[model samples]
Target: MAASRTIEDIINSDTDNEGDFEGFSSESDISVCSDLSDNDSESESEVDQPRNDEWTKRFTPITVNDFTCESGTKLPDSFDVNSASPLDYFWLLFSMELFVEIARNTNRYAKWRMDQTGTVDPYWTETTPNEIRAFIGMEIIMGINQLPDTMMYWSKNPLIGNAGIQDIMTANRYQKVRQYFHVSDREKEPARGHRDYDRLYKVRPILDHVTVSFLLNYNVGRELAVDEAMIRYSGKLSFRQYMPAKPIKRGIKVWMACDSNSSYLSRFQVYLGRSAVGVEHGLGFNVVSGLTNNIHGTYRHVYFDNFFTSIPLLEHLYENGLYGCGTVRVNRRGFPTELKKPKEIKNRGESMVMQKGDSNLIATVWKDKRLVHHLSTLNQPDDIQPAQRRVGPTVLQLQQPASVKSYNKYMGGVDQHDQLRMNYTVGRNSKKWWRYLFWFLVNCSIVNAFIMYKETSKRPRNKKRYTHIDFRIELAQGLISGYTGRKRKASEIDCIPLVDSQNVSGHINGKLSGPKGRCRYHLKTLGVRRETVYGCTVCRVHLCRDGCHARFHNL
Candidate 1:
């Protein structure tokens, strides 16, 4: 008798209201499913599902169905990476538009914060895109060389001081930016209990823009994987999820899809689960369908784990010309009962296969160390492949179905993505829950950029290759250099490298070969740091020549 609420509605409301969970939507490029029923009473798919007795008559022995989709790298054919900088690769995902939007919203929020507290801070000012880049550079370096406290990056103590990060901005400046960093306007957020009050409204703008960038910059491969990832937040929040089995026990749960070959994050959506789903075809079905909506009709095969695999989901994928394969649970409504615990499949490496009537849907039962059940729409029923199982120093061949083979191969993409992201993460302590997601996005940007850099460049420079740390360092240097170039352009010295990379050796104490300006390397007689011109024709700096130029270069 009550009106059926949608997935968004269920998430927005903290309490479980009685309604059929249906119709879903995202920004653009994602299609919504309409009026999907929650129970057999109204669900057409469940109503038509074959019973155990019916499955007995419809089930047939293994049969081959020759079907496969063309899979390849998706990229802009004309785009060249030969001369591209590391920053260029990073900018592919974190663009000028995104930066500008973030800066605008940050400034807006700063004003709101001040207005809400009715106080003004003396040191805070509107942040510029260049400053934001430098802030990000600082964050990147911080990830690479973690200290106990953020302020330690600019610590005066010898044990913790980092000149590389300090040169970008003063510690005070960096902390100020972090204090007010934001992405969406608070003034416009809908009031509680309103129809449009979204829990994720604060960071929705950032997600929308970055997701568009991610989708447009890379092409989807043939094998796509969907899985859940934790964002590592133990803070108090309504939707924060706790998975005891996950390495990260508590955080926001996000559903993600990644390209199987390269672990490229294709799409992601945050899970808003404050309460349980009171409907069939619950969370997993909606998540898979929404995440894969962009790839429908292209014959792409999607692989997931048992949580998302179901009879209705497989049928939905098959009907849309997409293929689905995943480890399945025997207890799901339409699963054949005979194969639930078949005693004959006791030997390791043995597998049983059956077709669902005459359709492309095939169910496989493989016996390894344990019995595994799989359902697939694209793999042939009888296509068995060889697998190697290790027993001490000896290895033996094990029989495997093609669907099992593919699942084993592609199911790790999401995990791989998480692993790569966890390394050198830009995560830090934050009072705002959204900031954790922000840092996660930053880590995603780094991982995605590095992947593109690895795939596209013959070598970034110097006939040399870059490791992950190398990429992060270079990216930080580029942002700092780029920012410095913007600040001063009055003379021959366009920019100078960070102190650690500078040619501090041998170049110092050289004869003054260039025009004269004040010396740059010495303290003034009054103990003040010199701002006098330190001109060097050789170094290309427009500084006034002082007698100390010789002494300055040596130090």
Candidate 2:
């Protein structure tokens, strides 16, 4: 057999897990989740085991191999990661062609607005792909060098100003690009009651484009996790969720699949309220199935939380080539009464396990600080792994199912992606709701691209790795490489890439632009430093003209 398979052929799925493949007329998209789990069947259960009021605890561990799945990352049949650049990796999820569409639609919107209101001087000019690219680059830079306000990047206040962004494109031009940005024609939008209407219609192009790219670009690992990610939005919308327990209390919910080890996002679906959320099949079941559609028979371990776990779902996964394990709710249907008893495991670290009447599924109830219930097709009920926990400044040793350990290890993929994105977020407060999603996708592009770079990187082992900030700065530089939106600054005439605080090399300049700052050479040479108005024009580091300027640039 080949070492890897083309993603599509990897599954070679004859039919969906639910039923025979019935080709639908609507695009898996058309501004929606790509899935084939739609079944009109009244029940999602294959066979609901008879309710057993009587319970018996089993101590013997299940040594079942009937439900084992393929392990490890599903390497692609062939990918050119060794020769790919950051921009090349980035194009996997987003591209200049997409930006060209944006530019065209923005001009259309600008014209529409101009015609609606009798305006004399419309400052809007048709933006080019490179200008749009520069705009995105500026956004990336701003994400890294965050100030109190967006205008600070263009401010004359030397204390907190960035000439690099201003040199690429004027702040007015950047704001104008943002102002008129459009992903789809407003005139072509379907009405609310129209069957073809999509709530995500405004940004459908990006949503569809990037969603496809995520799957097309990278092959995922064996341990993939599906979870919901919140994009913080306090704006009023029909489908916005408010889970008080989540760190982001209110925002749009997005279902995502990420590699357990790398946290590389492979698929994402924006929630569109009850209309898009299914009722016939369980929400958890539909969500897991839909997200993992392209990898059905690949035998990867899928980890999730209580929200998406159910007995029928695990059974369904077992029947297919996949395996599943997650912390499940006690109330969810399918756990035999044996595993649900509150006092089944009386002591901390003690656990009770039960198999569903010779079936492969095993439900484990372990008591720690409190009882933790887990359902798995991957691990036997009594397969335990020793772990340690701290309580009141004391570390206590305890035993847990290997599945619980796996769940803890693999379930943070989405969270990891979230952490990477939040560190340097782009975008400002906008009245337009779609801009948030757009910014989100841009951030995702950088993150996924960086991950791809790392995975496919051919750099020597001794070479220093690119930190997220370094990657963003270089990415911004590459994006603005061909920008001609504004006239070049005198300092920018022969300047190196505009790096934040980390200058590569540049000459000393003989002029002052704004307020004074600490002299670079004085800090290093004199063991004491003082602020001076004069600085190097290229690198923009302030230095004393008399003594520090020559010494600093020379070094």
Candidate 3:
């Protein structure tokens, strides 16, 4: 017999296009065609033209084999079934127990779903019950073995395919599992007085909600990512009046502090409202406090952004045995000095030092006994130099292009003329540079926080501070939220893409080419340094090392 063709082969065959049976027509068919053609040219045209109308076809004969078993095969013996492993027995017992629990307490919501779908009875009998039991059993096994859900299927029988195992571990399946695990009202309560029963059965709404949701989602003990998203919802009810009433729908603002690697360090959710009445109650602090209160070890550093970097807040963190580093708003009082207007502090040909005191700016130190509390250490002891006390603010300013250029020149580069031009441009455009500088500082702080968190711990925290403006900009740029801008200095013009170079390099010549001026790391003019690599993908411009990639990228 000829070899049977597979499905793929049959689909690939093109018998219609081959037009192979040229002389295989019957005499009657030929006569009928000739008669139709002779009758009318129009009829022949209509017959020859493709049918534009829809048509349907049906198949009747079976062309494929439908064998179930081979004649030589035999069923396994009872002894083989009895030889199952201990793990198998444990899984079966665990699953069955869970199934029983789910059957007992499946939620009213589950019932509602069943009712809406109009397949509750069939689902319950055919799949739901078994699935619930299986999931619970699997969960217990996972917990006892200290394994992640990702690895739970490893111990399953070979018959359970990857997809099948995944289906058994889904959120819905776990919900069913939860129903099984809940105790009956009668069991929860006792045949006793109301007060006594109430005392014994006190409900913990917050803890219960978190626990149940976490378990159902199979994230019981897992550390969540820092960049959790939030969407806004509103209601006209008096209770929700404080929320954004105009837009009606808004996005939640989240302030998150993460390490350098973008790992979640800490986060909080702040609702959108004109007043802090129903919001800004330190949701982040509460969560972090809870987490830290229950844990034993001390955190070395706690990162934060400008909004949360209040003196009192920092002091509180310090009291709790944690160090903090964050951007400080320029308006924030108590710095050693403040410059009212932007002026060159240092000049080669200047007569007298143009101090802020001599200029319009005035510096004052308020000794409010109520507010003069230290955050980490007692102001680094008075012996520390004044410059050191101003390091944070200086670092903040140096994050700008002009300051960067000055530093580069002070460091002495061989190409002095080009550096001078870059410096002059940055100095002349100080106002524009300052605007970018503010954003740059913000970005650098976030990036620094991300790096710190990633390098520090396994369970990073998140933030809760969102502005609609930030979100819209991020969306337009296709960037993740909380990104800061570039970290490069102004003197590093060589890092910028040379548009002229792009025009010169037409198409590829098949052979590898050297790095062109357009390349991100083109360091010839800028003088390649370790800091040039600290740029965000979007900016693709060399940045000062002080800037954070996460902040820059997002911005």
Q: How do the predictions measure up, each by TM-score?
A: 0.75, 0.76, 0.27
lDDT to native, each model: 0.73, 0.73, 0.28
Candidate 2, 135-156: lDDT as tens digits: 8888888788888788888887
Pairs that collide in candidate 2 are none
Error of 3 at 416 (Å): 40
Q: Give the CA lDDT, 0 to 100, for residue 544 in model 3.
A: 35
Question: Each candidate: RMSD to true structure?
Answer: 12.1, 12.8, 42.9
Off by over 4 Å in 2: 1-83, 276-278, 460-463, 488-555
**Which structure among the candidates has the greatest TM-score?**
2
Query: For residues 1-555, what per-residue lDDT tens digits would candidate 1 score against the true structure?
Result: 111233344224422122332322212322333556555444554444443234433443332222243333335566567777778878777776666777788899899999999999888989987777777787888888988888877676667888666556666877788988877887899998999998888877767666776765676577899999998888899888889998899999999999888998978988888445375686788899988765555567799999999999988877665789999999988897777888878899998877775566788889988999999977877788999999899898899989899899989989999988888879678878999898888889888888888877765466465788888888888876646312323232333322232334434322232234444554443344554433443565433344454445554
> Worst 10-residue stretch by lDDT in candidate 3?
351-360
Candidate 1, residue 176: how far the Cα is off, in Å? 1.2
Candidate 1 backbone clash number: 14
lDDT of 3 by residue, 298-348 (tens): 323343333444444444544543434343344544322222222433321
